[model samples]
Target: DAGVTQSPTHLIKTRGQQVTLRCSPKSGHDTVSWYQQALGQGPQFIFQYYEEEERQRGNFPDRFSGHQFPNYSSELNVNALLLGDSALYLCASSLALELRGYTFGSGTRLTVV
Candidate 1:
C-alpha cells in the first residue's frame, strides 16, 4: 500500500553535470512516468514506461531519458544539465495504461548553479 517515492528530496548541480532521480511506483502498478514541473506550472509529461519498455515520450531532448524496471520502479536521468534544467523533477505512477489517474511523489528539486 505504499505510494510512489522519490529520492534526495533536493539537489544542487552545476551546468554540464548529470543527475539521476529515482522513483518506486505504487503497488499493483505497471507503468511509470516522468514529468518536469517548473515553479508555479503544471507537470509536463516527459516520458512513460510500461512492460519494461518506454511506451511514450514527450518533447524533451535526448538529454531526458528514463527506465522502468521489472518491479515497476523507475529512474529519470538527465544529462549535460543546463541552468534551464533546474526545476522540480517529479515521478508519477499509474495502473497499467491509465495515464490520468496518476499518483505523484514529492519530487527531487534540482538547482543548477
Candidate 2:
C-alpha cells in the first residue's frame, strides 16, 4: 500500500505571501492530520480532517486552513504567511477513528523569506 506523500519537499516564500501544500494519505486511510515542526521542537498539531470535515484544530490563526477530499487526500493553505511560518509541514494519516500511532510523510519544508 502507498504511504503518505507530500509535495514540494521544500518551499521558499516571501513574508506575507500565501502558500498551499498538498498531501496524499496512505491507502485505505480516511483521516489526515497536519503538523508544524519548528527547528528543535516537536511537531505541533495544526488540524485534523476526517469524513471530509475538520474534526480538530489547534491554536493557529485564521490564516491556517485546510481541506480534505473524497479520496482521503488533503491540502493545507496558509494566507499572508509570516516569517515565523518557516517550518516543516508534516502530514500524517491513520485509519478512521483510530487513535493509534500515525505514519508521517517526509513533509514540505516551508522557508519564509
Best by lDDT: 2
Candidate 1 off by > 4 Å: none
Model 1 weakest 10-residue run by lDDT:
91-100
Question: lDDT of all predictions, in order shown?
Answer: 0.90, 0.94
lDDT of 1 by residue, 1-113 (tens): 76989998999998999999999988887889899999889989899999889999999999998888889999999999999998898888998757678998989999999
- Indicate the worst ten consecutive residues by lDDT in candidate 2: 94-103
**Per-residue CA lDDT of candidate 2, range 13-84, in tens?**
999999999999998888999999999999999999999999999989989999999999999999999999
**Number of the predicted model whose TM-score against the real structure is largest:** 2
Evaluated at residue 44, the lDDT of candidate 2 is: 98
Clashing pairs in 2: none
